[model samples]
Target: MSKIGVVLLNMGGPDSLSAVEPFLYNLFSDHDIIEIPRLIQKPVARLIAKLRAEKTKHYYEVMGGKSPQREQTEQQAKALQNVLGENYKVVVAMRYWHPFTEEALRELFTEDISKIVLLPMYPQYSKTTTGSSFNEFERVFKRFPQVPVIRIISYHNHPAYIRAMVENIKEHLQSWESYFFLFTAHSLPVQVIKRGDPYKDQTEETVKLIMEHFPEVSYALGYQSKIGPVKWLEPFTDKLIEELIKSGVKRLALIPVSFVCEHSETLYELDVQYKSLAESLGVESFVRIPTLKDHPSFIEALRQLVISSLQ
Candidate 1:
């Protein structure tokens, strides 16, 4: 008869343009994300953040001067809380920005909870995403070892999750026959994959699972949002768009398979940048299947994961 705590983990974004630099600093400072030696990480992070802040701020400005991810994740938390009812308290623990994992743990420790569930917003597992968040959690959790923790690592192939994505995609499609599906995920450096990260494989598996429902539909997987000049998971999404357009594929449907919420990557990169690129290449129609943000099925999927973890 004790309360359960559910903490949703995500890579938080700046709430406003002013917060952009610090957010970037926090992100780059994380050793799990930007691999730098402990001695010079902060200095390098500061320099990188300073260099990128203006351009990054412009990206956010184009998307209404802030990232919608925090709001979307909070709404998802509320929805999940409602689904779980009074017995569970759901909160978000963002890795890089405000409402950070430290803050989330502080709030949950104050609650009369019996156990805590650490659920990453990412469906696919990657050291840079879920692993980074978990590392932060473990650092903060040292303060409250008495409260048992249950970690739901990637649920990439979870039936409920796959069903939610499939359902969302189905609802958005006018006719599956006319559109060429492109499954695009946030790209990681190729070095990360070589280091034994399961991200690439898991992402591919998620796409494979979702595509099972649309056997006849033409689809290809691509990677987007690569940082710096490092070789990332290929083929790059922008290049893929060009390839498809040149190949006589005029109508395309882009699916952000790795993301569960709308953020800069989806809103600006996919919606504006990629859309513009596709249009410039004479793509007749470019549709982006929306991320499953608090969709009823997605909420149900979260609820099921929590319930199963409890048992």
Candidate 2:
């Protein structure tokens, strides 16, 4: 039997504080991110990375000098591998850091795999996430086009994924009373949307589907992780939290909707930074629903996605 390769894609984070700068340089250098001419973007990306490296290092320092994304992603990859059986090989491909897509592709090319399944870890399709990863994958896989590639673009509304998210949320919340739900997604620059990115819409769809499972739960949607002066999707999660607090909402539940696994954004950004913000705003309870990393239903969803793609 020919080996089936399953490639899981994600925006890889720096493994340690020292690698953060170069990782940022790689990230900002990507056309999908900076969206400028190569010559100009390269130097600009370097400058930005150099300027931000110190501050970014502090973030990693607080999180124990590294990001947990690679570990968490490996956990998901391992789970998928187990479910897919011995004949299947699962690869974890990160966009900007170690074990990059190129490395994964090279490794797979040497293997006895007959076909490749590209399953992006991002549940929603976005030019920045899945699109970027696909673009890179295509560029590398050009060398082995004979090995057919099946891509699963997005599974934002997949039943198993939605169920896993709902279950994770229910498992986290100690009580449903007096708490309002906030479905938070990572924010993208407004210009990205103007350029016809469907990320926001797909994220909304995910929210709507999850909302269906909680008709009695009062919930709202917002964006997070905005950087720089650029106008990002609004109302921002922090501002929305403030609004909820001013409106006499004492308890708040936050769900990192776009993220399927815990990373710096969830741990440092939402848990540490946003938690502090919520407390300062007089929020009595700030509950952040965990990401769906290695959840049985989520792994099942990945299996289904691969099965459908192979067909």
Query: TM-score, each model?
Result: 0.98, 0.97
Number of clashing pairs, model 1? 0
Q: Model 2: residues >4 Å from true position, as ranges?
A: none
- Tens digit per residue, CA lDDT, model 2, 205-255: 999999898888888999988888888999999899889999998999999
Candidate 2 lDDT for residue 159: 92
lDDT of 1 by residue, 1-311 (tens): 67899999999999999999999999999999888798999999999999999999999999999999999999999999999999988889999998998788778767788999999999999999999999999998887747888999999999999999999998997887789999999999999999999999999999999989999889999999888877889999999999999999988999999999998899999999999999999998899999999999999999999999988
Report clash pairs, candidate 1.
none
Local accuracy by lDDT, each model: 0.93, 0.90
Instruction: Assess candidate 2 and give its TM-score to the true structure.
Output: 0.97
Q: Which regions of candidate 1 fall more than 4 Å away from where they truly are?
A: none
> Which predicted model would earn the best TM-score?
1
Instruction: Write out the backbone clash pairs for model 2.
Output: none
- Overlapping backbone residue pairs in candidate 2 total 0
